[model samples]
Target chain A: MVYLHDGSFEGILSGIYKMFHAKAKIDEGKLYEASVYQQSFFELTLNVETERENAHRVASSIYESFGHEGFKYVYYAYLAEDDSYGTLLFRSLKQAYKIGHQAFDALGVEDIRLLTQMANKVSRESHLLLGLLRFVKLENGIYYAPFEPTQNVISILAQHFEERLADQVWVIHDTKRGIGAFYDKTQYHLAPLNSFESLQYARDEVAFQSLWKDYVKHIAIEARRNLPLQRQHMPKKYWQFLTEMK
Target chain B: MEIYEKLRILADAAKYDVSCSSSGHQRGNANKQLGSTAAAGICHSWSEDGRCISLLKILYTNQCIYNCAYCVNRSSNDVKRAAFTPEEVVSLTINFYRRNYIEGLFLSSGIIKSPNHTMEQLIEVVKKLRTREGFNGYIHLKGIPGADESLINEAGLYVDRMSYNLELPTTKGLRLLAPDKERKQIIMPMQQVRDQMIAHRDMKKHLKSTPSFIPAGQSTQMIVGATDETDYHIIKIAEAMYRRLALKRVYYSAFVPGSTHPAVVERGRPPLNREHRIYQADWLLRFYGFKADEILTPDQPQLDLLLDPKCQWALNHMAYFPMEVNRVSYGALLRIPGIGVTSARRIVNARRFSALAYDDLKGIGVVLKRAKYFITCNGKYCGDGDVEPVYLRQKLLEPPKPEQLTLYQTHPEVFDESEATIRGLLT
Candidate 1:
């Protein structure tokens, strides 16, 4: 048996909810996102429609059984850029149903270990983007930041900024994924936005950016020039939105 | 001067002080707040020199009254000089912070008229950022030597961390390089700050809303290769400071030749390797539970350039090798060359469920190549039944595969401590 989801966190959980209810005995790797479902040995497949209530019920049950850290790992693992995340997360949750919180523990198990690895990678990338994400002030006084993260971590970064910069209105755009998280002064929501090529900057945006570039150029000690070390900390792929790098 | 030109001049002058940490401060945002500091900090960008630009690390003013020979902002230097007004500094901080260009402000300055006056100017910027601008972000204010105790106390209230750079390790080096700055003057402020932090923490234990005073604690920076102090002297001083003063961190910066003074330049290249080794040794002191004397003795003070301090210590003290992975205590597991704090803890936890064989070690995040030689799996040795120091040293220095050494070079991050040292992430 195979279960296909819509490649969203809720979609994966909702699909898992159906799998748990039916108790269908299935082979390994029988679960995947609908977009990534390749023709494998499995013959029977079902595209599980996303059920918001079912997803919420499954998530709360995991939170109740596996603890908060386990709940976070499930979400972060789903956010990681891996095709096996859906299958592994579903299997781990199934294992969690029996073993309780010990499912996140028991690193010797392959499914739990791989799921933990993905969650750690996604969490680490989100933390890095929190710092590396650069913001530009728009003419309308909204703080607009755009970056292309390897993982689907725009929501994590958005939630961080929604608290850190609560009073200021901001928009965080994922250039590669064509999605943006917009926050008003009161609350925040996610929306699709691809047209960020043309932006009206505040009057002093270019001036402050130039000043930042000048400061970066001068603050670096001339004798201690190590581009390789610089790349190791701030990888090359993240330089596009960096005003100083530009 | 224009703000652009002033920023360049002031930032260039302030680049010599190499304390860029923005971690260990946890301040939550209030209602409709503009900023909040994270305990695990956020590094906005890495500079060309490969250092983190956590804060807007600029001097409040480069106009100095004292002519310190090793300082770029020295009164005797012919370089460009600039000073920022209170409004200019406040505006730059708020704007840069809003754009996510920096974590917060790292405001240091050259001595102006008096130490008290210079300290006041630095405090004013931070106070305006906190009270007037409503910023709860991290603020690392550099303390002015010879400043009054009252001023240091007041500044500690508004800032997250503070430091007074000792520059050189020994008092003799201070006398030679920076004649105006005294060792006692620098040490006094550190002592006072440490006392205040202790009192604040004690008060917080009783009252929840005591209003944190330097919640991030104090850290100091020392120039490594400038003076004639060896790694032993520098590490010893760092250990003492960490022990006696309870300093959060002690940053070491290698001397950048040909930039500051004519007499200061001894070689074309700075002693970067030596500086890195000292940082690793310092890591062993702080985290790895190794003593300063254990790292270096007076007879053989120089750390091995090729091997890390932990590996060197493991080689020199061979009696502690072949530690049983399943049965050895967590502290003993940390003594293994390749094992870190994370791996050691993981091994302890994983061992509870099942005995960790050599095959299972990799699953628990152990770097097997480095740990295999020193650690054992259920009393089975990975290298050989018998340990030979000379052979082990040679084998460790050689690349994993001889042929691949020609085809590719291993990244510096392959080893953990050295990477932390160079990247300034040694917390």
Candidate 2:
């Protein structure tokens, strides 16, 4: 059986309704697939538009059993592009209903622990990106940086970068999701940044980078030539966008 | 010229002096400053060497008179030299602070012309930041040895904290390594600073709201493994400093064998693990009420790289183990291998309502693996059956001594799974 639905919260809820009606087992499939969760034994349903009541019923039921913390985990996991997250979310909700608050203790068990750990890890990476991600300030003084992050944490990252580099108008485009956040004057918003190349940056960027590179170079004492030590401190991955590396 | 030039030179020179912790100071807003110093848990940063960069730590000048072999800024090293006038530093500090770049300044210097000359310049920077700039930010200044007592006293009044680095552990180490520096030059200034602080406190008892003078207290740095000095000798010196001088901290920096001086050991840098273990030992001495001789002996001059200082000591004295958790006194609570000050307090607080079982011990954040061998729950031993003293010692120390990773965190990957486990050992 396959349940194909539009990539929306309502559509996913409608699919959940079908699964409940048939009492079908959930299976993993590529999220981007037009037809996903297909199995040979059960009937395949193509559900597109979702009723508002059906989506609300599914969300409220999970919320009733586990309170707010459990709902937040479910919503975040749903938003995560991985299809396996949806199955884990379903299993966690079903188990929580079975055991009540004791199920909340089970939420701290290894499987959910991995999910929280991954979320936390992604959150930390995004925060670091906000600080360390360098923008090539263009001739017109528009600062821009495009990064491909493994986690969909660009939205969280955008807030911190917007606060820190407040004086300038900048753009942090997430290449993985083909979306970007823009901070112009006071307001900030997320919008599609389709054109990856031909992006402009501030003119004095090269000069500033030269000075920064020279600064880091002068500080590194040659007598302590611990490449292993240096690699341990600053990883090769971060060196890609660093001014000194260029 | 530009502030960047001064920062590049001054900060680079200051990196050598490993005493930039914005820690153990408590204060609220007084005059016109923006932030207050915290009592504990101030964040530290990492240099290229991966050391914690807690402050905008910098030298007043790299120019020197005394040539200490263990110091990079010794008189003979043919390195580029620079000096920051007091006003120059004040401007840089204000600018960096405004940019949210640093918590405060950690000012140290080479002995330029004389110790008094260096101390005066260092004093001038703290004074200007305090009175002229109205900067109430956390400032940790290094007191130059052999400087005028009055000069050191005045410097202490303006700075949040001050330190005198005992570069070598022993007097014999001092004579051999740093010929010009005497043991008295370092200890004398610390004594003067302590005397001034005590006198200031005494006057404050009568006067309501007497001004703060070095409210964070004084600290000192000891260069570990620099000479033939053992960990026993190094920790002994630190224990004495903590007890006699009332020092707030005694930082142990592993000798990095890069000093250009002819006298320094060119072969092996001190195992970073040894320095880490010494810090763990130092913590036990301060908070756990453990004595230096109790932690280590001259015969066993080195700390076990595998087990922590407390764990090693507990292994050595297993007859004292299986102390009943419910009835053990607070003094005995401190003696348990895995029980820190926090966990001991937790046990005391939690046991007031209910008797703590083996499970409840975990709730109080005790490591069951280590603590099980030492503590008894409801007067029953939960440790391994083969709990002989020698066997326990071997068990505690046999865990593969994970490689020593430097505490200097410059990048993210320095914390790969294996290295992060090692990093935990060092911090």
Highest DockQ scorer: 1
lDDT tens digits by residue: candidate 2, B96-137: 443333467888887888788888888888888878776766
Model 2 TM-score relative to the real fold: 0.65
Question: How would the docking of model 2 be graded?
Answer: incorrect
- Interface C-alpha root-mean-square deviation of candidate 2: 7.1
TM-score of each: 0.93, 0.65
**Residue A29 displacement in candidate 1 (angstroms):** 7.3
Off by over 4 Å in 1: A24-29, A39-42, A97-99, B260-265, B384-386, B398-427
Residue B107 CA displacement from its true place in model 1, Å? 0.6
Question: DockQ for the candidate 1 complex?
Answer: 0.65
Residue pairs with colliding backbones in model 1 are none
**Candidate 1 residue-wise lDDT at B29:** 83
Interface RMSD of each: 1.2, 7.1
State model 2's lDDT: 0.70
Q: Please give the CA lDDT of all the candidate structures.
A: 0.86, 0.70
